[model samples]
Target chain A: MSNRREIEREAEHVLRELSKHLEEIELEETYHVIDAESLRADSSPELRRGFREAALSIAPRRDGAHYVAEAGTWV
Target chain B: MSRQALGEAEENLARRFEEIERRDREINSFIELNPHAQEEARRAEKLGGRLAGMTVAVKSNINVRGLRATCASKTLENYVAPYDAVVVERLRREGAVILGMTNMDEFACGSSGESSYFGPTENPSAKGRIPGGSSSGSAAAVAAGFADAALGSDTGGSIRNPASHCGVVGVKPTYGLVPRHGLIDLAMSLDQIGPIARDVRTAALLLEVIAGSSREASMLDVEPQPYSQRLSADLSGIKVGFAKEYEEVTSPEILGVVKRALRRLEAQGAELVEVELPNLEKALPTYYLIVFVEFFSATRRYDGRRYGYRIEEVCGEEVLRRIMLGSYISQKEYAGRYYRRALQFRSLIRRELLQALEEVDVLAGPTTPKLPHRLGERLTPLEMYAYDLLTVPANLAGIPAGVVPAGRVNGIPVGLQVQAKPLQEQVMLNVMLAAEGRA
Candidate 1:
């Protein structure tokens, strides 16, 4: 097997072992639910603008009003 | 109160700045000292609110306008915060001087403070050992007296772990009790921006200011209380719970310190109770699974085009591991077996804790399962993950938890952790105050 493939297999084995310990934890009626609507409230325009400017100022590459992003994966 | 007193305060503040600069050269606790700190301290002295005359160092993950919120990663090496995080704003409003940003594990991923792109933060209390992380520098700054108090975000023991190892006070408020507006996310569901201080009262004051309803972010519906005023050393009639699971996992030396501290509480009239949390052992896996998924989702914005470097390209080994694991688990093929299962287990752990709390007023345990490993120790990933074993359950349960200096083992600090039900911070603080010998 390729070295990369061997490492991948090892990782899988480790993850499997970790998951095995949690297997006996029986899931009851509960689900991890988040309220999407409550998280959607609008901020004041002044606050929004301040956040926008701060975010925009840090962008490494900017074109006019848009942040220019690389199109393909570098890795 | 007088002109001479004000002048003296200013003189003291200048000396503190000099001390921080000189000492931090060796400790590496601070990432950047606030250039405007002197002016801000002068202003705070004049303004005189609840936190006036207090100097606060913020963890790098929490934003302070005009300072770099690097999260100690090369990905955000140059990313300056555009605005104050809600907690920072609250502190500024109440006349607290923002000292500067402190270092942390790269993207808050490591148990030890050694993974920062800037450099590792040496433990101030335990020389030649790691300051527990990712709130490493926050706790260290307080330990080294560089700041009166500091702000650190706890996802799973980030604040409390360092607080324990460094012999300071750290509080992780019940989830949503503190607003998360300015914090860069590690795991939003579990992350809480909280206070680290030399004493419980200062931590309570910081928590009071930062924990409230905010227009900028979704917060818990509960009203913030005057936690500082509510603190008392009296633990009379309070039932302190201990889980066998916690005792089972903690190292003998640290556990001995924690038990003796619990006896101190008992001396002050608190009753001890044994509580069963059958699902406690499963919390670590549950926490990491949830963290991995949420962290991967949160890092999608750092795609190299918009802000910082692509995270996967610039992040440390631990970070890359989580991102890859999260990506793999999130795939349609494996999501159910891992991520979904983890969520369900999270709920089980939460239920177990809530049930345990119903039988007792608070739970006590060692903050971390073991003493901090020596700096530069070659620890496996599992060894690093073990540090969160005792700390993660509170985050999972969305409860208030804190660490108080229990005593020392071999001159290394050990913390006695006290946890209370959701939104019951005052009760937890009282127990911690008793642990601090204020009783």
Candidate 2:
């Protein structure tokens, strides 16, 4: 737990220094967001099948056609 | 070239494979050798493209079909890539034989190569010293002649850092200039997959092949240029910029070596101009803030559900540190204080670099602030992060940067970094060619 705290402290120090520098610079609030839309072409049937097989090849848990994933918990 | 010449080239490649098997036991540069490399070389000889008969090493973070994309971590120890990365696909089409996947700093987290789970890569050039990371093996492989060239991705100096330490040329193309479709990236916005090779022309040729528009990659609108044919040693009218901030951070020994290289460029008729970047100190902190957030987000995919082990459970200390810090910084309450501000600083630094480049063609500096430490030497995370001080601004600004062997400091090779404006790889490669001539 102490080790975790030390790491947190180190992160805090870095962030605090950055915060100070940010305050010194006077710039308008600007948002630079890259559009998240996928520009990739639709995969051909063969390509899609290859991708599915490849994905299944590495999956730790999978049924015949479905990949098994851990349930997200809100707690 | 005749059939006999082609046969000789195949024979040379066969000998290189033998050399890798023999020499890489100590260097640990390759994570795995391609079983089909000889057959691939033979196929390349018959097909004959731009890079025909040239063998290449791939950094483990980039996908090469059927090879383990481990990122030097235990988590992905068995995750074989499903398909070749766009770059690898391009290399295959251009007739370059894939040598194999090489080692790296786990999750591309460390500047020194020591953090790899497979064991640290030794500096083949410096002997017993560290090979800089996280593209450690790629550069070392080229340096030790394991491959004619190699592919390495630079987020914050990963490619050039190792290239500098290993005495080879490494390039980080403009962020959007090279596609990142299949890279397991550290920070997506900053990552650019580039070439590491024995000389400038080979690096330029590799860059020309792999850099172009791809629907798989977003924001990559820059058309690929014929970089190799444009190379010239005559720098009669080229303007090179030097920054005091870079010198202030660099050790005197490394700086002196860099200064001598600058003088050589001057003798070749290149003009050196002094430029100022007042917010240079802020770049390191800004770079880390963004990397932490992005890396944390990227690692969320490794939950042991679909592929690989849950990263947090099996990653190295540096990887976990970035993950934890990234998680903390991405919190809604703290995001504005850290991550968002870092983005604004990124813009500011980009503007500063573009402004500086207006007066000068390229900026030259020492690739690393200090020489690489000895292998297994313990350093605090901050100390390790400082190694990227001289190289991160280029990434932050999304510019093309390349490192050429400058000279030596205490028998350890130093690199002179040349950074050009975004999509100005030809200009950057030309300066690198001049430095290579001096070297």
Give the number of the best model, judged by TM-score.
Answer: 2
Error of 1 at B330 (Å): 0.4
lDDT per residue for candidate 1 within A1-75, as digits (tens), equals 124454355456557766888776566555458879746446633346477678678989887777767656668
User: Candidate 2: how close is chain B to the reference, as a TM-score?
Assistant: 0.98
lDDT tens digits, residues B1-439, model 2? 3556566557768888899879999999999889988889889889878888788999999999999999998899999999999999999998888999999999899898888999999899999899999999999999999899999999999999999999999999998888898999898888989999999999999999999999888867777889999888888999999998887788999999999999999999999999998888888888998999999999999999877688877877788888888888777545377777888889999899899999999999999999989898888787888999888999999999999999998889999999998888988998899889576
For each candidate, the alpha-carbon lDDT, in order, equals 0.88, 0.89
Instruction: For candidate 1, write residues B258-332 as lDDT tens digits.
Output: 888888889999999999987777899888878878998899999999776988777777787777777777784
Off by over 4 Å in 1: A1-14, A26-75, B1-9, B332-335
TM match of model 1 to true structure: 0.88
- Docking quality band of candidate 1, CAPRI definitions: incorrect
Q: First chain TM-score in every candidate?
A: 0.35, 0.34
Name the regions of candidate 2 deviating beyond 4 angstroms: A1-23, A31-75, B1-4, B332-335
Candidate 1 pairs with clashing backbones: none
Error of 1 at B402 (Å): 0.2
